[model samples]
Target: MEKLFKQVAIVVDQDDALVKNLENLVSLTREWQSSFHLIYVVERPAFSFKNIWKGYANGRTQPFDTAEHRLKEYQEKLKKLLPEGTRIHCYCKEGKPLWLIRNYIHENQIDLLLLLQSGSRFKRQPIRFSQLVGKINCPMIMVPLHKKDYDFKNIVLPISHELPLKKIMIASFLAGKKNDARIHLLALQEQDAKRQRTENPYLFKTYQLIRDNTTLTVECHPVDGDNLAAPTLEYARKVNADLILVKPGSETSPPGIFHRLLSKFNFSSSGIPVMTI
Candidate 1:
């Protein structure tokens, strides 16, 4: 990993679904030695009677009482779950969840942002996540809420034109480098049958780059499909991959087909975790 993710931030949604999977996030930070912060946002009440409200002796109000108590419970549980001596800080905010998260990231200069795909706050549905995917300044990894545990023994990496190589290799390392994982590279080939017969030479180089760097058992598969996402997901299932690591377009570049598909994607429906850098 060229740039160490020394600081990580996880946005716990209103449901706290992702907070339940805190172990998975902690395990990711072990290698990087990143200290993470757990952040929860309480949406501002639809209507507030701030002017007429009489605060308690301590100045705590009734509307925010439940939110404060819930956050305290989460903080206690998370502190117990984290490794010994690991620095962890928890915060609760009141505002739009998305904006609060963005502001927090900018203020803290977080190196990585971890999020969960399952939650009730997503009234805007996939578009909400798509907004984050399109605009997050730091690398973000979103894990779908699933009943199963993560093995991370096999990772399926899809390679397309202008793939984000640096971010991807870093993510693969963090997700599975120590697990002795095998990175299966599924190259998205053009649909035209006569256009190409051989694998892209860059695949070998990428394999070499990852393998040499991490000693990971990197392999490649040529997938001929109309689009990258569908076949990539299929091949990922075929390999029984633990995670599908992708690199969304950078802020400077236009949104790619992958990013476009991700905007409308319901990751939980796929039953696999998708980590993007």
Candidate 2:
């Protein structure tokens, strides 16, 4: 299989949990043969309190030197610690962190964005997370504070009518890359799965097309109830899913809010990359 994720980046801050996050990035992309970039945004402030304390505090260390210092340190650590021959780059920019991160993701053609929930520069505003889900083109792996092993086996996805199969297939392809990882699909509506299979065969077509001789399995189920997120999570826990894929379009539709709130959870443990299309 071809490696689709060749370039990956991690958005970091002075206070982020870099040690564990970096370790996970290495593990997640080891198969991809990927290059890692450490991105630090200075967060261009909108107002006040600048000249009031502009002098160097500790000799060469200025008021704003801490972030830069941390970024440089991370760069050294990444290059020293990553697998031999792996490429590592560090970037530090002063601007709105979101825009800088977005622009960097686009310009660098980053295939994945690894972020730690704690010490993130942005306040983890639901709107910001929702916006990233709706706008950013890369798949992101968001790690929570507690460290737990998440696997691809029993990967679950919530598919709505508006969600594109191609997008869902992206996740399936990723999970299926590992032998024995099963991709389970759940239609967010109350409609019957057999009926939908009859009505729109493409909704269930991923298995036939994606799985061939691999241990990866594909199956779709109708959620049969309201509040799709809860049921989806419940089913995922029941199946012991290591990851949950939010179908495309759920980020922009009415369930957008649900996705936003759901972002707060530490889904990475189950191999849930905490990603959107």
Candidate 3:
């Protein structure tokens, strides 16, 4: 089947590892037959010493010579890595990384945004990217630069009763385009298996939907866990999943035990990448 996303925008940074990771992601997208765009947001220095003294200074403001130079070097590297005749574009913006990326997605009509799992500058506080989850309309894929494994053969798609199944299905289809990839539609049943077998009709409905639409191998499993993250992570490990697709729920709500558990399961720490839909 043809790729669902015609255009994929990758947000680049100064980190070499991140650039390499983005290149791999773009390669996968191209294998699925999608166009790629590379963007590097050149942030203007906060305040130059010369600009601080001058009143209403324009020329005194710092020039993006450093940023432009770095961007050019990365562009060359990316061009060499990508296949010949691949369409690639770069943009340099002076603003916050998250906002610039979000705006780029909107203005360019991008179908998907590929970003390094954690920003180059903010590694300790990686959850900051989670803020953009609700803000952006298009789905974002976070790739861990430190990991060498790229094969996404086994995938876990966590399903809850909250979000629309259509959205999850669409995202899953885009990520797992190949027929051989295994997708597990996991649902954590707070109750026992016997009770859940009789109670939850949505589980069966989701299973039928996947079976009817896609050729990929699909399985449904009911887990026993009071906290959603525990069962999800356990199953992911058991299946040796390469990716975990989850829907970001309300952040303002109090952090339940499940939410806390998820916070601990850092994408950087886990060899598998987590894609929050």
lDDT of each: 0.64, 0.61, 0.62
TM-score of model number 3: 0.77
lDDT of 2 by residue, 70-118 (tens): 8788887777667788888888877666787889999999987776665
- In model 3, the clashing pairs are none
User: Across residues 56-109, which tens digit of lDDT does each residue of candidate 3 receive?
Assistant: 253222246655776677677767877787777777766666777788889989
Instruction: Give me the overall lDDT of model 1.
Output: 0.64
Each prediction's TM-score against the native?
0.75, 0.76, 0.77
All-Cα superposition RMSD per candidate: 6.0, 5.1, 5.5
* Order of candidate numbers by lDDT, starting with the best: 1, 3, 2
TM-score of 1: 0.75
Candidate 1 per-residue C-alpha lDDT over 175-204 given as tens digits, one digit per residue, 9 for 90 to 100 = 554557678887755534677566656666
Clashes of 1: 0
Cα displacement (Å) at residue 141, model 1 = 2.0
